[model samples]
Target: MSTFKQGRYSRYLKPFSYLVDLSIINGAIFFFEINITNTYLFSLYISALWIIISFKNDFYEVQRYTKIVQVMTLILRQIGFFALILYTFIGVFKQPNISRLALGEYLLLVFLLVAFFKFFIFYLLNRYRAAFGGNLRNVVVIGDTEKSRQLINLFKKRLDFGYKFRKQFIIENDDFSLQKCFSYIAENKIDEIYASIAELSNKQINKLIDFADNNLKELKFIPDNKDIYAKKLKYEYYEYIPIISLRDIPLQVPINKFLKRLFDILLSLAVIVFLLSWLTPLLAILIRLESKGPIFFKQTRNGFNYSEFDCYKFRSMTPNKDAHLNQATKGDQRITILGKFIRKTSIDELPQFFNVLFGDMSVVGPRPHMVRHTNLYAEKVDKFMVRHFVKPGITGLAQVSGFRGEVETDKDIINRVKYDIFYIENWSLLLDIKITVQTFINAVKGDDKAY
Candidate 1:
């Protein structure tokens, strides 16, 4: 029996969305009677621009498992950008005779209508999938981990998501292998494969990827949160169980990168001019008086793409041979009397603003580790290098969230990498500002791990 059901309608969703959106846009134009010098040309241009904007912002690319919040975000982004493009078109052509109020009303109408239709379709589809069992995907899970079991349960429970639980392959015994899994997939007509990455070897994983691609089946992993994969992966939520795919990083976008770098430059310049310029001299005098070494300490640290850079910091400890190899612990003997004050206040990290200005680091990102520690942790910790996807920061989500200073245990670094990867994958200007504010508050209040 072909269990595919009426899911073939999934293919028509994009086209239907396109037709309805175009109708709503043109219908509003006629209803509003917005004045344009040439009605036909203006209509054509705006309609085409709307399509391009939709594609650009993934407006019509709603997936079965996508959340309503994500749908709202997509609508808002698409409409906001489309509005800007529309106004820019008016200004460029000097369409001063066009009624501004009429255009405003038109845009408001378009947003409301488009959002209504989108939510309506989303809700209707959910009801259809749950009540009528339409648009369901037959899936097989390949592991018995807690996460994988949770996902299987989700497939059986969340009827709206439309994943039909087929079978789970447990690889715990000697009888199970990739060959058997592949045979099962082929026999059962599995539309998607969910694998627990911890249960498979690197070679086995490669074969599974090849098989999935060759068979035209969607493959997703139920990852062990403690381990990191080097491959580019994206995360989606199946009502809270995270699904990983080829990651889409916001910072990788050109505009986002430009904004972050611009913010870094402006903030670093301000700190250098107003604070570090005077504070450095006072600190320099006090450090020279208390210790014999230089005021600034430079160490090689890993940055984006595993590139080595000289990370700068105010000297917090007296000269020691173990500086590069060892991390500063809670009450280290090498920390000078002045070092204690500066370290606790995080003033020692001020010289890093120079690194930020020099473009070696960011104001907010994964905190850089010494070259030696980087090498050690890359081997000891899973996904430790995932943080290297973005430039290292003087302050990061990990640091502010209580994972700063010394690495006392393996679990400590594991949690830190988890937070670092989260920040990198979900970077935003607003998130950066929030983290910066939280960092300031933590500094003022003092951190137990600051030492």
Candidate 2:
């Protein structure tokens, strides 16, 4: 009974959404004297736009378990974008016959009607199910890892989905008793079972299938081999056998990342040609006059995907300063007088524009750690390697958030990693710009920790 209910509700959502869209279009056409041709074009454009944008925003993601406010916001955003595009088209083509006032009123009416309809329908369905106690799907998970815990937490947080989580059954051996688990499932009225495919053997998988078949329940298995951290999965049919493969890196998703890289490359090139070219010469003269050593200090650092690269910085320490990968301390004797000034102003990091041009790093990302320090801290910090998931940067969230100085303790590195991970998870062009602005302010202020 639960299986039938789940399948029916799942299948109904798509057709329901289409009907709502059609109803909105009909309402708009009735209210305004829109040309049939323009109406059809506008409807088609909006339909496609909503579908594409919603998919990108994960609006239809079942796991997201969206709220009414969230759905309303998405609907408003879609309508706004659609109106902007429609107005732009009218203006650019000089379509005088189109009534702009009518169009605006129709857009508002359609948006409000459609959003309210969708929200009301979902709300009523939820209330009806709750009234009858009919919508809850009992689920059992098969693992206890962080991933499994995450799944459990999502279900718990999203109660509107009406999922009642059953106990997580730990599978110990290939020959575990399926009969006992099946009996328990029947008694508990389990609607579905989710298992980590990597943790279960062939025999256990078969047992799960048999249990599902007997109880008429659904079974879903999570793949274990894939790096779940990377958002790249494609479903394809090969000889009628469906296979899922990692699509592409999320950073290479669309014009967004490409445009970002282009911006980085052009900006880095400009800085190198106009700013660094003159500045490097002046800094070289100052360094040579003050001390007797090279103009740049090249050190090996971990780049994207844990790759080793030589990071270039204006020499800020005296000759033969490499002692033990030791970070600079306050009043360090090895730092030259000019080096102190350059370090304080963060001008010493200007040489990294060359590194950016060489594709060793990005303008904004997790700041790269020295190779030796990376090795040392990987053992000390939890999930430290996650920082390598993206290219290292010259300036990062950590730097802007006051974690940019010498990491003298485990806590400093831990906080730095926390901020870096946060940046990676919530990256955007706006965020990059914000970090860059903050970094500039910090640079100008010459905070004591900058040294």
Candidate 3:
């Protein structure tokens, strides 16, 4: 059998693994005397969540060389998220007849069954490869870049990955050309091609891609500046042409995006109705009495995709044209009596619930920066623009972690952006809730900054 055909056996491992484990879950559910009638919906929800989490986590990727412990840990995380989301849904909807007995036993069984089968299957595959090189893929490296050379070396070192290089085509060589690479592939059993795509023109890349497709070969590319990019980017295949647009921003995923928007709407509406309804009027009175400017401060800030929107605050400072240009500092005379109280307590940001309601912001995200700051930071920091991929927030990971208030030095902005990027990349509903709770706790205790 061909190497590609032999290796295709692992492609079904993911779905097959999930299905077997899901059966175990259902069996455990039945044995626990849980009400399966009503909880059928719950079962379906669990299956759906499994697929989503798997896709997001690359759980289906057939990495035969992956450690058993790593696989177990990945499944553990997947199961944990699955459990949390299921229970949260049940609690939110107030679903009845869910026995802790059934859920606990089922989850435990799932983890055990999944880990057992994953280990067993991978073990069998390894043994098979040891006995016969049935799953090995013949590949070629077509680039002179250090990155491509390193990749070839890695393949040579990690023999268990089943990658055998037929030829290493160095573009810098005098005789190296596309025709030469193709001729070599035609003569050898080449299963895949890894080229340093940064060195290839669009035409060359496209031709190589078509050549791979026509000849049933896999074409992979290595960028010259691989270190400058994140590894977790999503590869989108458009009409059989692979285009890596950007890193995997989970917020941009359809389901995650929808759910977050739903959460923002629900929470923002509640805050606006309950907190801001009464609080806004009361703060307006205090501001009018203490200051000469408008009760609400509206400033243009860069939000999702660097679009400028009016970020609402409770007029925390005396209105100045330089509000857009300057960062507030401690004991600044521009801040009135009410401004100081509100800013310190984060009450000045209360009106931003309105921004959330209007879909201008999220309750939890990277805090939007002033247009001036956005431009400045984009220049100073690499990948700083990535923060704008998601909607800005009134309270963020940076703010809750005490990275808020005045930007005094380069380190301050650097740490803030670092935290912001971390939040964007690692976003989850649970993380958002944790950050929200942290923000509340910090507000009660107050921060040294926020002047």
Candidate 3: pairs in clash: none
Q: Per-prediction RMSD in angstroms?
A: 14.5, 16.3, 14.7
Q: What TM-score, computed on C-alpha atoms, does each candidate reach? A: 0.52, 0.51, 0.53
**Which is better, 1 or 3, measured by TM-score?**
3
Please list the residue runs of candidate 2 whose C-alpha ends up more than 4 Å from where it truly belongs after superposition: 1-171, 174-252, 321-324
- Please provide, for model 3 over 1-451, each residue's C-alpha lDDT reduced to its tens digit, 9 standing for 90 to 100: 1111112335466557768866765655665655445667767777777777776765655465566667777778877887787667557657676666666777777778777776787777777665676578788888777667777776776566677767888877888789888878867767668887777888988778656533445566776654555667545331223324333567866558767888888988998889998998998888888778899888889887566799988897877878878878888888888888898899989889889989889999989888888777776765566676689998899988878988888888889988988998889988888998899888888888867
The global Cα lDDT (0 to 1) of model 3 is: 0.74
Model 1 residue 431 distance off true place after TM-score fit, in angstroms:
38
Q: Give the CA lDDT, 0 to 100, for residue 26 in model 1.
A: 77
Off by over 4 Å in 3: 1-233, 242-246
lDDT of 2 by residue, 246-355 (tens): 21235634445555677679879988999998898899999999999889998888876566889999999987746338778888899999999999999999999889
For model 1, the stretches where C-alpha displacement exceeds 4 angstroms are 1-9, 246-451
What are the Cα lDDT values of the candidates? Answer: 0.84, 0.71, 0.74
Residue 440 lDDT in candidate 2: 81
**Residue-pair clashes, model 1:** 4
